[model samples]
Target chain A: MELPGIAFYIVAFLTMGGIYAILCLALNMQWGFGGLFNAGIAGFYAVGAYTAAILTSAGSSAHLGGFDLPIVVGLICAGIASGIVGWAIARICVRLKADYLAMASIGIAEIIRLAIVNEEWLTNGSLGISRIPRPLEAFYSGRAAEVVFVVFVWLIVAVTFLVARRLQQSPWGRVMRAIRDNEETAASIGKDVQRFRTETFVVGSVFMGVAGALSAHYFKFFSPDATEPLLITFLAWVMLIAGGSGNNLGAIAGALAIWAIWSLTEVVTQQLPPDWATRSSYIRMLLIGLLLQFVLQRFRSGLFPEKSPKLRISREK
Target chain B: MIDFINFYLIPGITLGSIYALGAVGVSMIFGILRFAHFAHGDLMTVGAYAALTAVWVLGIPALAAIPFAIIVTCLAALLADRLFYRPLRDLPTIYTVIASFGVALILRSIVQTVWGTDSQVYMTGFQKPTIFFDTFRIATRHIQIILATAALTVALHYFLSRTRLGKSMRAVADDPDLAAVAGLDTERIIRWTWIIGAALAAIAGVFVGLDTDVHTNLGWNLLLPMFAAALLGGIGKPLGAIAGGLIIGIAEEACTYPFFGDTLIAPSYKSAVAFVIMVLILIYRPQGLFRGRLM
Candidate 1:
């Protein structure tokens, strides 16, 4: 017997793939471009999703569900809220280097998650907010709606990618790279390195927020459980590191490859014997670890290594 | 208030000793290797499992299994370092951190696969509750844990201060290159560091399991608290970790008591309490309370 409705499966896969692409790009800009080792991308993503959900869910006639703003507006608000949170964290913790920065960001992310979990009045706690208004609910429904959502998401991804590319080539991007390569040199050139770092952090985080908002709308639900670090944060890190840290396209490629492999593994595992299928999920985690080790060993520079501006421009020319 | 002290304070000290032991291993690894070993928690879990396995499968006594578990864990640590870490020694510290995370995931998966996901209680017929007074009662297991933690801490302090190898480890932590130049065997020191730290972690894990139940997520859940304690005490300072752990543990418990009949603070906020304390300490004194060497 074959699984039915393969079309739905394909659409779902692409939809998830597109959202992850956006998430990876956002992480790429922060870690790849700015050399900020943020371990809290999931926190920001959750913040955006919850922010939109909460804002739109408030003032409703039934169980805090009424404000009813447009999906685009909610998305924008999510971006702004996440940007603000990112900016605040950067301001406080950006002065530290690798290990300290990682610890601080992880701590901040945990705090964000805990706040979301405990602040039942605001977040509705673990029960989660549901019945979120879909964009273009009147015009599109079912598979057609999913297709339209995917297109809209890809549109956002394209716009964000272009903007990020432009920014990376700009004078500001050069200064950011300069700081990443050599902080002392950047400071010697009279660049306010901390401010630039914070700005890059906020901008990158805004993209993550936007991606989260898109995901929330697609799912039409939001929960504190979704904000946990293990779910989204590490996956994004793996994608970025596996693909190529400093390259946006590499991030997208990494996202797609890893997710596809993950999904395919799940599908294949379901076909195994009962005992084997039961243990396969654990084995899959081991495989992911082994895959990471393998990737680190063979392609330390990642799949699509960061290209110099001269090479990139030449290719374009 | 007196009842509160008898109940919360004493129990907090018992719990804190376990946290302190775990933190010492984490802090030492961070000190020498210069990376947050996310796998440290899983190492502890593995140690607890080792002890549990020794008791259940090998028919060893719980007390006897503790030392054996520690030794096995030390060997495991050495193997991990040799296999995974030694190869990446030349890379950036961040790479090591990521690799440690990979190691953690692998260890967790392996444990789950072999033992299944059920919580394991290592009850080697060693269940006795000790009563201190009419109002105060403590588990004999907890008292044993506290005593063992004290003994281990004292032994570790002596070893670090008086032993030549321990001095060499400190030197390596200070500067690997300088230690190498000063005729210290850097590789040997690092191996010893892993052995000692992992052994300590094993002891802590077994002690914790004796008092509670051993579960897969036990180590992962303890990770943040370990970090908090290590950071609160200077990261590399073992004694400071003890003090930091006690302070955090007591504060977490104390905060949960209802003040003047107002709504009692939820116990779920325990992690938040530790986190808040950690953030405050970091903001005020990023170097930590004891202000020892950067680790």
Candidate 2:
């Protein structure tokens, strides 16, 4: 690839990596901390994107696009909408076993996808929401636009990372881990296991929603068809697992590394003949699938395994 | 009224049988192996293509192609079980489920890349609809599906009830440790579960393909409905799956009636019907209608 092409790819990679970073962080909180096996990451992410799209776009009759809200408001609404749905999912599904949770979440994701496709009045059907009110819209284009967006995504990731790190060190975070490791023990200690799980799920989903909103605004397009639930969910899971699930820094690294590899595959696979070119993406999917199994079997704890927080003898000042 | 019966009822029975067959595979896998087989749908797609190959490519009769597809798909599923599922069997349920999802991805991609993403048929060119009493109308293909599914179900029922291996399989599912202590080969039981499950799944896939056109994404598309049927029937209960499948198949199409109203929801939203039904079931009876194993 030429320098400009390389630069463009890097920018694109970071922007998506940043979005996935947020997604991974959310998933890390749920799976790593709370031990909630949420297979519906795509559902929550889609909710966030669509919520942002509906809120910020000016009303038109192409489907049902008349929110015309401010960007900040749109993003927050995305988070709130996602959180609300997540809370419901948690309340209903959290008590189930980890594997069962996976099934139920898949169902949720499927329902969301169907809704996005069928409910034309709410989601604008398949045409999708475009001309999105991106940040610094008039002030930049092309490379400059890419730089600004990457910076914007980086800021979000940074803030989110800090929040997640802080949470990891907090007493509540400890409780979440406790519940995950031993639900019976956590409950016996007078903790409301279900409530904490629900709260953690909501928090993670809120972050996911905000990330989705940013993704929408950056791309300036949103649609149900664009979601691709299973792949998106699997991508986040693979990133978190590859990063070392409980480690915050590892999540960031995993997000970037996995996204880069995925991008490289897309680039390299483009040189195939037309017939092969049409199907190369599926080959990438096949690789990811095999890679997931290999990692799970061999590098179960991931590259940066979760640090078992030491038993601290606290001396309150 | 006759339009409704012919259009909805006959189609419903045929669709239900397919769902039941797939759900049997799902519930059995859940019972013995103890994880939701997410790749079961893709396996069904594999069966469809195998049948397509048997008929369209290999010049086999359409009817015989069903069993050939079942055998071929079973072999592939068996290989997948050994490579992916068997190793993770002793791990946490979550690990196995994750592996299964990965398997789903791999299987789906295999179908897509190998088969190409085009609609195909085992035998094309429409035949005249067969009418019963000049009111109950079903095409030749539909009758074939109904007979095939009924035959499979009866065979499955006999296998589960009258066979020593089936009895042992049930014993293992109930308590693997005790069954092991009682001298049953746990490995063999697991193998049998996959065999039966895969066979049933292939049958379902081929039947569904017969009803419509075969697509690489067919299995992925059916995942939700199959899972819903399996769950509704109760996780480990074969009978429950059959009942659940029938109800789901009927309800999915029937929802376009006064319940949703045609204006309320398009026919394209048929997939959502199963999801909604599953959610409602989970909300009320997470153990499922048959009161099967919750886990």
Question: Whose TM-score is greatest here?
Answer: 2
| Count of clashing pairs, candidate 2 | 3
- On residues A78-108, what C-alpha lDDT tens digit does candidate 2 reach at each position? 9999999998878887887776677778888
Model 2 lDDT tens row, B165-200: 988877776676899999998888888888888888
Candidate 2: where is the Cα deviation over 4 Å? A273-275, A310-312, B258-265
Residue pairs in clash, model 2 = A59-A65, A59-A66, B233-B240
Question: What Cα-based lDDT does every candidate model obtain?
Answer: 0.80, 0.85
Real contacts retained, model 1: 0.50
Worst 10 residues of 1 chain B by lDDT: B124-133
What are the TM-scores, per candidate, against the unseen true structure? 0.93, 0.96
lDDT tens digits, residue span B144-261, model 1? 8778888888898898899999888777766778888999877777888788878878887887787788998778777777878888888677778878877887787777766677
Fill in the DockQ of model 2.
0.76
| Candidate 1 residue lDDT tens string, A213-305 | 887888888886654456477678777789998887898899888888878889888898998877888887788777777776677778899
Q: What is the lDDT of residue B136 in candidate 2?
A: 78
| Candidate 1 Cα errors over 4 Å, as ranges | A1-4, A57-66, A225-228, A311-317, B59-63, B124-128, B133-135, B259-265
- CAPRI band of model 1? medium
